[model samples]
Target chain A: MSHAIVAPVVLPALVAAFVVMAARFDLVLQRTLSIAGTLTLLGLALHLFLLAGDGVPRPYLLGAWPAPFGIVLVLDRLTATMLVLAQVLAIAVLLYAVGGWDRQGRHFHALFQFQLMGVNGAFLTGDIFNLFVFFEVLLIASYGLFLHGAGAARLVAGFKYVTVNLVASTLFLFAVGTIYAVTGTLNMADLAVKSAQLGPEQSGLLRTGVALLLLVFSVKAALVPLHLWLPGTYGVACAPVAALFAIMTKVGAYAILRVHLLVFGGDDLPTAGLAEPWLVPAAIATLLLGTLGLLAARTVQRLAAFSVIASMGTLLLALAMPGPAATAATLYYLLHSTVAAAALFLLADLLAERRGAVRDGIVAAPGFPQLDLLAGGFLLGAVATTGLPPLSGFLGKVWILEVVRAHPAWPWLWTALLVTSLLGLLAFARAGSLLFWKPAALPAPVDPQPQARPVLPLVATGGLLALPVLLALFAGPIGRALEASAAQLHDRRGYVEAVLGPGRSAAMVER
Target chain B: MELLFASGVGVLTAVGVYLCLRARTFPVVLGLSFLSYAVNLFLFASGRLVVARPPIVGPAAPGYTDPLPQALVLTAIVISFGMTALVVVLALRGFLEAGTDHVDGREPDREGRS
Candidate 1:
């Protein structure tokens, strides 16, 4: 059980290495290995999730180097929950890609496995520096995956994405350097303790460090003013890569919860409530921008991309609020939004594939095979994205609305969220109407090309679409678990003790 | 010395940001490299400005500079080096494919109309 903590990080790593070294020329072997690896990870994530049901933070020391010295990977309710979420999405995405998308590029399976390793490591590692390393690992893999098929549009977007991330990475280094210099330890639990004992003089530096860190995460999360790279990147990326990217944004959200909320959350600290003044307002702006962009989007892919930004806004808005109720809402919404966005992107790709010349431009194009079925799928995806009733999106938004009552500016928040949600619905409705409602034959009709049945892609998409419904059905149990996870998240002392052992954290050994 | 070092880092960072905001890809890549150098230097300085001190705990060692920041600096250098290589190749590819060095894949419109 203790060793299972490392499996989520190590398993994909071993598979990724073996796949590259052994199955370099064999796509069949690569697919089989990747599928088997993801399934195993899903099983491991479930087991760990159950293991963490007791709400104890379980730390696995790397090479027994001990916490605050070497890296430690902690498995707790929040970590376990994120693990399960990532693995589930990985399974669906891997299934979606193996159909034919993996054929577009070399090392897709290998890079994907490494991406999993990086994501799992980021979630599991208890040290901030280790988190940065894992972030690079995932990002490097994503860079390859983004440029996988290599086209003019993709190359242009790739340049921007790579440049933006590189800049953010430098900022990350500055933030880490500042933080380590001030705290004398890179271990998160140690920082939590050290930060509490900090003199007021150091608060400014600590705030500067973490604030820079927040800027980096905001780039990843696609928060406004920092979100320019996302639409073009995701919009031009092929569907499977774009679907996989849904989890990447959530990784940023997760970082904020772990580092910003837990490490910097104490009322005793001068930096307490640091994200308060701007986070919600920024989130509101992000929502308005995303929804407006969605309405303005000329292509189905762009529409889905903008919706991702909007859902992130909703998730971050809930996250910025203090209290377990809000955090629980944030977590629930995180699950809903990631899956929903993936489903929407997948459906958009299907539309692109079917409409040969039009290529999912929201113009009226005579659609192709299974048009009605794809339209139905689009309806559900848009419903979940726009927070319509009977799906998890509506439930998630309801939970968020319920939790924000105590917020000092709840009235403004309510107005903005509701108004933007309505705008989001209108945007999707317009997109759905333009794409699905009007079907006019092209000036020169596309010749019917013989194509293989899209059974796998359709099944994979349907499988993704099923999750939002299932989440709503299982809302009772899931809500209870999320509430517990949220409570555990706010209990920073528990985490400190779990990583560093009892009373060890408070003892400042000045080196 | 601290003033000189700090000024160097700040100047590099300022130039880097300015170039990063430019319209073309080459300058952006160069800017990123400059920013990376600035960060690497800043990170190294985080251990404090000490010269010729070994990062060892043994009695033979007179003193030790903080070794962790050096390790971190090495990691940053490697990542930035690899990333810079990637962006250079990507920019070259984008130029060849799109026939434009402009970051947006096309020439800027004089009147800002599509």
Candidate 2:
């Protein structure tokens, strides 16, 4: 069972190394190895999910060292859920990349595998420093992936992305250093215990450190005033890579949720409720920025990027509120937004491929072949992104609204969400009509060249588009599971006890 | 001694932030490198700057330095080194491809459209 917890990280690392060493030049072998590795990871994620569903937080201590000393990997319901989401998206993006996208750049397959390894490690690791290492692993891989096709625009965007993140990484290290200086521990559970026992002066320093940490995560989450790098970066990235990046922001959200709720959540601690004051207003501003960006975007890819930002805003708004209901709503909305954003990116790529010179620009160009299929995909994606009815987007938003209705900030939250949804609807409607409804007046080409759409790419994208549909269908069981996970998250005592043993956390509290 | 280290870190970070806000690629990369050095020092100092003490545990030793921060700083130094190298390469690539070193990839518009 412990091995299962490690498998997701280990398998990808091994496969990535093998691909670099043995299958460097063999595209076929690399593809086979990559796919097989991701499939195995998906299987392991599902297995871990089942094991975690029993409500036990399983902690795997490395080298048999006890808590606070060893590197640990915890497989709780939240981690398992994240692992499955990441693997599912990885497999989908890998399938799409296999349709000649991987050949566009060197080391694409290896970098993709390393990226998965980083993400999985981030989700599983129980120590904060390990989280930083995994974050770098994933970030470095993302940098390589972002520049895969290597255009001038991509190069420039990649430069900005690297610079911004380097600064953020520095801040992360500084924050970690401060926390360690004050508390002398980096393990999450130990920090939980130590933080609660801090004296007044120590509490002030710890609060500063915790605040810095939250700022670092906010940058990763692309909260407004820090989101300038996202649109440009995602806009210039290739379609499949952009699709994979949908989950990257969610990784930041997960860090905030996990660290904030677990380490700084004690009622008597000065750091308790630290994030709430800042997160809500910034999240609302982010929503506004996203909506305005969507309205002004001239291309499908940029519009899709803005929608991603908007969805992140929605997720963070729920997260700012402290309750199991809000956490559950955030998780459900997170799942829906990730899938919808990825599908939109892929669909934009498909449209770009078909339109040739127009390349997904929001202009009425002559309709290309496979019009029906492309139109249907775009419509479904548009509906999902705009949070229209009969999709998980709608369900997730309704759930969040319902959960936030009783909060003191309910009026502002409700207005921002509803107004933004309306604005998003208008933007998508305009984009859809311009791209699909308006018929161009150009005559048919005399050459009559027949372009064949690859069956595999379509299948890959179709599979992603089907997710929101499936989410809505199984919302009952999934909602229940998320509620249970959120309850477990809120029950910080259980987590501390699980990792530190039954009496240890209680003993610390007594002292 | 601690005051000197703190001021050094502060100066490095301030200069780094200033350079990072510049509109060119090379300066920005250099700034990031400087900021990383400052952070590394900060991490090292987190162990409380013990002097004349061994890092290893010894039965006869009076007191030893906290070895964990050393380990962390070593890992952090290696990671930051790699990061700096990667950024330098990326900046060079951007310069080569875009025919300019401006971080925004183009000359600023007369109307300030960026």
Model 1, A1-511: lDDT tens digits are 2899999989999999999999999999999999999999999999999999999999999899878888788899999999999999999988989878999989999999999999999999888889999999999999999988889999999999999999999999999999988988889888888887888898899999989999999999999989999999999998999999999999999999999888877777766888867788889889889989988999988888999999888889999988889999999999999999999888888888888878888887775777789889999999988999999999999999988787888998898889999998888888888777776443434666767865888889999999999999999999999999999998888888888889765543221
Report the Cα lDDT for candidate 2.
0.91
- Clash pairs, candidate 1, are none
Clashes of 2: 0
Q: lDDT at A301 for candidate 1?
A: 83
Worst 10 residues of 2 chain A by lDDT: A439-448
Q: For residues A195-273, what per-residue lDDT tens digits would candidate 2 score against the true structure?
A: 8778897888999999999998988888998899899988889999999999999999999999997778667667889
Interface RMSD of 1: 0.5
Pick by DockQ: which candidate is best? 2
